[model samples]
Target: MGRKVALGGILTAISIIFLYLAVYLPSAKLTMYFLTGIIPGFILVEMGARQAWLLYFATSMLSFLVLGNLVNAVPYIFIFGIYPLIKYYIEKTRNILIELTLKLLFFNIASLAVYFIWTRVFLINITIAFPIVWLVLGLQFAFLVYDYVFTRVIFYYWDKIRVYWRKDVR
Candidate 1:
């Protein structure tokens, strides 16, 4: 539908802008990546899984081309960018324990992959002040918080913002 296509285009553009900002603002790179991740959820809710996937691929490719530095898009491409879609499917099982386990499993695996790619492939040196175990634990905790916040934002959009937009579109 025209509405879906328009919204998808808008969200994709917004995501690219965030990715662009992430390149310029080193301190806010993570935040920008997180925001870019959130945009796909809107497409998922408004359009569907297929549309969301399209948006993800479009944004990923555009970010890579526009940024011209794989390092800037690494976190988004590896983890944050695709997380919303992954989360949606994972949560559909409707079992809290299974969902939590699978989500954490995905996070850990993706994170390790990202670390491997970042350090080994990119040759970036990440100097951690503490032990690797502590870093892993901290990352797990942060992931839990991110998941909770992501759910809340989705619910809020569904309950409040989506209502207005749905009416307009109809």
Candidate 2:
């Protein structure tokens, strides 16, 4: 129990640092934000969905406070941080069609929410020229690639380091 708490705390700190880096370093915002997503994946793999969610809530709330701009953290909190658990359940379903369908549905909903926040709340002139359909399709493709990469990363960690780490996780 103590070990889980310590690990969760550590991952939460790392996630917060990533959020801060994204907020402070404009040049590296994309990279830092994407990197932040990986922390939740690690937690999901190491602890479980419940612990991963705890970390997600902690990171998301802390990110909003640190960012001082809800728009900036919406992508992380809604899409990135939660992807791993979604992936876990999708994979467990063992139905490629259902997995693909659910994955696309989730991505579309999240993408629309992000889009709505950016355009409506932040008033970022993004969809002025580009059609909303195009934007959503692009996001869907990107999410597909992201999902593939996430699976590959999980495989790599599972074979290389997860065994050793799990020994101390409980």
**Top candidate, metric TM-score:** 1
Per-residue error (Å), model 2, residue 148 = 0.7
Off by over 4 Å in 2: 128-133, 166-170
Q: Which residue window of length 10 is worst by lDDT in model 2? A: 161-170
**Model 1: per-residue Cα lDDT at residue 47:** 83
Error of 1 at 101 (Å): 0.7
TM-score per model over all chains: 0.95, 0.88
User: Superposing all C-alpha atoms, what RMSD in Å does each candidate have to the true structure?
Assistant: 1.4, 2.3
The ten-residue window of minimal lDDT in model 1 covers 161-170
Candidate 1 — which residues are off by over 4 angstroms? 168-170
| Candidate 1 Cα lDDT to native | 0.90
> Per-residue alpha-carbon lDDT of model 1 for 1-170, expressed as tens digits?
88778888899999999999998998988798889999999889888899999999999899878886778787887789899999999989999999999999999999988889989999999899889899999999999999999899899998889888676654
Compared with the true structure, what per-residue lDDT tens digits does model 2 show for residues 101-157?
A: 999998888878888888888898873577877876787898888888878878888
lDDT of each: 0.90, 0.84
TM-score of 1: 0.95
